[model samples]
Target: MMDVEVIENSNKCARCNYCRVCPIYTVEGWESASPRGKLYTIKSLVNGEIDVDARVVKELFKCTTCGSCEVICQVEIPLINLWENFRAHLNSKGYILPVHKKLREKTFREWNPYGESREKRADWFKDLKNLTSTNSDLLYFAGCTASYRTLSIARDTVELFNKTGLDFNYAGVDEYCCGSPFLRTGQRDLAQKLFLKNYKKWKEMGIRRIVTSCAGCYRTIAKDYPKIAEKLDYDFDFEVLHTVQILDEIVDEIDFEDVDVKATYHDPCHLGRHMGVYEEPRRVIEKMGIELIEMEKNRENAFCCGAGGGVKSQFKELALAIGELRVKEALNTNADYLISCCPFCKLHISQSLNNFDKNINVLDIVEVVIRTLNK
Candidate 1:
């Protein structure tokens, strides 16, 4: 059974519809697309008031789980976790979405969410041996996307690490997905399995601290894993740090060449709101000596890239719509480039910009750092 407390607390939403004003659903303009609608549907299912149908299940899977609704809710409903629990319950009832099911299966078998071979996981570090040292206290956890699709980010991050004189080691194939995807999509059992595998590996390697570039991975490792660990009687005693946080700590030691580029940042929901890490990334950007332009909505109130909550895989159109809105917000700043700390945000926003034929450039903060270092 799902957590009783979560069910009780979530049911207190009272259908106030305060959360319907979120930019995501406002842009989509659908009632079933809103968080309250999904919550009521899930509550009905739990109360046996309505049978679980494919249409109802599809609505539940569409949400990015960005928690914008929870942020604005007067009743303080844990909508994100509540939706996740409902997804898990639906999966247990054999109602898995096809794409998500395939992704989960591949992640379970291949150790990466993309379902690719693990042998190529370390390909991003090719010819970059000088960038990392063998003995370093800092461990860079390059999530699957950066390792494969966004190899440039992985390369730039390592270059910045070397430029900053930070000792770093990366676990290549030995590293597995941090299980953020699984957790967000309601495959908690699989997420727990992945966490156990990763925690054991990190423990055996004597890793005292961890840093991640992916906001989802950062939140999962730093926040979710601890609770999972408690249930399994496993103690994970390590500092889970975001790369931006680490970069902020050493911002003073580095110097950047003057770059006259206007840039705006998109706050990845997991990193900015969920983890409360808004300042460090901004600090790093300012330290780079670039003009930091703020979107009308930023920090805790910033919009989501629409890639979270398994929406990218389940509802591609809606995810792209959310990403397009974010891209437009950055473009409104008239910034030459848009910067985000999360690789997933970078990927989604980049696609949206291309699709919309907008000229705004999308980049990771590490990419900006590496560029400034070279300049």
Candidate 2:
């Protein structure tokens, strides 16, 4: 978000209706929730046609910020950037969402968005002997979700790295937040502070390459961190690779046995569209010799898992609604395992599966590999 007005970007919306790919708009079917409608709202604000109000702010925050609209925009508007700017503007104008405000407070106090204690951040990997160390070729950054919620993914990923004989350091409790949550919520200033903290911590460890299991961390650290770094007067240029990318590189050494499960891969919005990493995760799945079922929406045109852009926390009903739609799509493929790369996506989609009373299992792509590794 720059010091300029949202009009600069909002004016670029051509109203071509190409942004119908937005999952929120697809389910809600409200023009105010569509990407095109949001841009018009911003323009209205700029032209003094409307004042900042809770209703307007609520409509703005309904967006998932999955970057789908920006991908298909006919006029090439920076819709993601514009939406973030609009949020920031609203925040400055005291039209902040109450849930987002509390989330910001929790992130600042707990150093994690879930309001969980930072002391237990690395408790996920405490059982692995000699797995946590420094002065290695790379640092395995177990993001907050992986470290706290998806413990198995973190453990399996570290085990996979060791099996492949990669020299990587694990930044356990010391690993600061990658600021993905805050950035998605337009708390860029707080995000920059975390960015500086993480960068300085990594610099002290002399870390060269960084690998993360979570897709949001991948997008935040790899894509947004650089821009945040420049804004905060910090200089850093280290390589950040998602675990899928690293696994794709070492696929030759890892032996995955055939599994009897029919799995459909869910493209996490940040990893696939935000980072352009559609092939690597799929390559890992294909190499395992399992049948890959195609979802009606996959890759760039893929539907969002409804977890991005703080929607999962604030708009619970809308989030679950979109996730259920995705789960129904996966169930349509008759896939036993609904595999996705990001832990957040797994969490949301898995919850939605419970609502449908379906027997589908939502597993991370890496988790799927870990199950079949050496079997």
Task: Encode model 1's per-residue lDDT on 190-219: one tens digit a residue.
Answer: 899889888888887778899998999999
At residue 76, what lDDT does model 2 achieve? 82
Q: What tens digits encode model 2's per-residue C-alpha lDDT throughout 258-365?
A: 677788899998898888999987888888887889899999989998988989889999999999899889999998888888888888888888877657888987
Candidate 2 vs. true structure, TM-score: 0.96
Q: Number of backbone collisions per candidate, in order?
A: 0, 0
Minimal lDDT window, size 10, model 1: 129-138
In order, what lDDT does every prediction score?
Answer: 0.85, 0.84
Which stretches in model 1 have alpha-carbon errors above 4 Å? Answer: none
Q: How much is 34 displaced in model 1, in angstroms?
A: 1.2
| lDDT for position 205 in model 2 | 84
